[model samples]
Target: MIKVGIVGGTGYTGVELLRLLARHSGVKLQAVTSRKEAGMKVAEMYPSLRGWVDLAFSTPEDARLTECDVVFFATPNGIAMQQTGELLDAGVKVIDLAADYRIKDLSEWSKWYGMQHASPDLVEEAVYGLPEINRAAIRDARLIANPGCYPTAVQLGFLPLIEAGVIDAGSLIADCKSGVSGAGRKAEVGALFAEAGDNFKAYGVAGHRHLPEIRQGLTRIAGVDVGLTFVPHLTPLIRGIHATLYAKITQDVDLQALFEQRYLGEQFVDVLPAGSHPETRSVRGANVCRIAVHRPQGGDTVVILSVIDNLVKGAAGQAVQNMNILFDLPEGTGLDIVPLLP
Candidate 1:
């Protein structure tokens, strides 16, 4: 069994990892660290995990993470980079659910995240953990930088077209909306119920951090630098991301067939039948990205809709997927959750 350690187990992503990994038959929960909540029983803080998680939150120093087979850093940006190199040297695989190593350009990452990277030497070593695109790399990687929630949905929606080179990459527009929970489990005025609820507005229009990451991925996919206008919005719900991607169709091949064939064997990416609309709720709580492709009025602009539970496919669930790949287990071993619907 794979011994697993999770750092920062108090946030939405951290607990989400706990909720999934706690029951993974192939994974043994080793340690979970939360500096502020150290010594608190995991179940006591998140009653939902009462029967599944018997471990208590420990300080990072007490977690003894290097003893585990794999350690997941669900901490804020700079925390993982500070300790990842040591853990890697100890032969423990590390996966960070933050922006620490996702952007290859250290300067770009620092500019957007507002902090200098702690381990620039390891930046190139950390694989970008988007399983659909980097599955083979993930299998051999000792370190991984999990993709952000918004980037996950947007990239998946635009990938097929980008790969096929059937879309005008320079004019790509990702108009996306995510649940309030995407902000993370925190006490911020923006995330407060009274502020975020009954409110529908966009933020980071000038420049969102996820923009560079998504652009970098698409550029890699297209084999050329691509221009993208990525605008992220906050919705009133709690756990999903809906990305409506727009790209100019440069070719006439069947749009539906393109998307379907591209994701034909991909278990987590479900291409809905033609003319179907994928709702965020349809993928809530599940590590699945449901997509629907359309060419409005048979026009040049192709609109692709993609949805995923931000905490699932976007963060924790995807982390577990990477873990399964690293351990040579079935990709869906611990992620076979049916999406929660109302």
Candidate 2:
């Protein structure tokens, strides 16, 4: 079994990792760390993993994460960078579910994240963990930088068009909405039910942190720098992301077949039939992105709708998928979860 350790065990993504790793056939949970919650049973903090996860929370210093085969950092941005280098040097693979290593430009990362990178030397060596685009590198990488929830949905929706060279890349718009849980498990006035419930508002209209990551991924796909107008909104729901993307079509091709053929062999990305509108709930609780393509009256514009469970495909589930690739196991080993329905 592949021994695993997780840092930051009290957040939503942290517990989500525990919930999935608990049932992985090829995995064994070695350590789960939380400075504040040390010595607490994992099941005590999250009742959902009562029977599956039997480990308790320990401090990072006591976890001995270097002894594990791979360690996943579910902590905030700077936390992983502080410890990832030592772990990698100790022969333990590292996966970070944060913005620590996503952007290639160090100055850009510092400007957006507002701090000096703890491991700038390792940033160039860390592989971006979007399996669809960087699968081969992940298998040989000692460090994985998991993509953010919004970036995952946005990049998948725009990838087929950009790669086919059928859209005007300069005029791209991504209007996305995510659940309140995307803010993390912390207490905040914005995430409170009284404020977010029955309300919809865009917070990062000027520039959100995920913008650079999205642009970096898309630019890599298009083989040139791409311009994008990204706006992120917060929804009252608990666990999903809906990305409605728009681009002016510059060439004529079978849009449906393009998307279908692009993701033909991929198991997690589902391209619905032409004219279909994919709902966020259809992908809830599952490690899948359901997408649909449309052209209003065959106009000069193309609209793509994509959705995924933010906690699953966006965060922990994708991390597990990366782990599977890192170990050369089947991509869906412990991720065969069905979407939860009403």
Candidate 3:
């Protein structure tokens, strides 16, 4: 069994990782660290894992993460870079579910995240952990930088169009709406239920941190700097992201066929029927990105609707998917979970 340790096991993504890893047939739960919650029983904090996850929270220094086969950092943005190098040196594969190593430009990362990268040299070596796009690199990588929630949905939505060169890359737009959980399991005035309950508002319109990461991925695919107007909104829900993408069509081609063929064998990306509209709830609690391509009135623009559970496919679930790839297991081995419905 693959021994696994998790850093920062108190957040939503952290517990979600514990839930999934506890049931993985090929894994053995090793240690989970949470400085503030050290010595607390995992199941006591998250009753959802009562019967399965029997480990307790250990402080980072006491977790001995280097002894595990793999360690997942579900901590805040700056925490992973501080410890990933040591773990890598000890032969433990590292997957950081944060922005620590996603962007290659050290200066750009510092400017956006507001901190000096603790390990900039490892940035170039860390593979972007998007299975659909970076599967081969992930297989051989010792450090994996998991893509952010917004970037995952947006990139997957725009990938086929950019790759086929059927859309004007310079005018790409991603208007995304995410549930409050996307804010993380934290206490903030913005995330309070009474504040976000019935409200619908957009934040980060001028700029969002995910912008550079998304642009980096798209530019690599298009072989040029892609122009993207990314605007993110907060919806009055708890756990999903719906990305409505737009691009002016540059050529006439069967978009449905293109998307279908592009993701033909992809296990987690679902291409809905031609005129179907995918709902965020359809992918809730599952590591699947359901997409529908549309050309209203056969106009000059194409609209792609994509949805995923922000905490699942967008975070914890995708991290597990990356771990599966790093170990050469079936991509969906522990991620074949069905989406939760109302």
Which digits, one per residue and each the tens of the lDDT, describe model 1 over residues 1-342? 899999999999999999999888998999999888899999999999999999999998999998999999998889999999999999999999998999999889989999988899999988999999999999999999999998999999999989998988998999999999899898899989999899999999999999999998999999999989989999898888999999898889898888888898999999999999999889989999999998889989999999999999999999999999988999999898998878
- Candidate 2 stretches with Cα past 4 Å from truth are none
Q: How many clashes show up in model 2? A: 0
Candidate with the greatest lDDT versus the true structure: 2
Which of candidates 1 and 2 reaches a greater lDDT? Answer: 2
Error of 3 at 234 (Å): 0.3
For each candidate in turn, the TM-score is 0.99, 0.99, 0.99
lDDT of 1: 0.92
For every candidate, C-alpha RMSD to the true structure in Å: 0.7, 0.6, 0.6
Provide the lowest-lDDT 10-residue window in model 3: 333-342
In order, how many clashes per candidate? Answer: 0, 0, 0
Give one digit per residue, the lDDT tens place, for model 2 in 181-218: 99999989999999999999998999999999999999
Off by over 4 Å in 3: none
Weakest ten-residue segment in model 1 by summed lDDT: 333-342
Candidate 3 local Cα displacement, residue 197, angstroms: 0.6
Q: Per-residue CA lDDT of candidate 3, range 1-342, in tens?
A: 999999999999998898788889999988999989899999999999988988999998999898999999999999999999899999999999989999999999998999998898899999999999999999999999999999999999999999999999999999999999999899999999999999999999989999999999999999999999999999999999999999999999999999999999999999999999999989988999999999999999999999999888999999999999999999898898988888
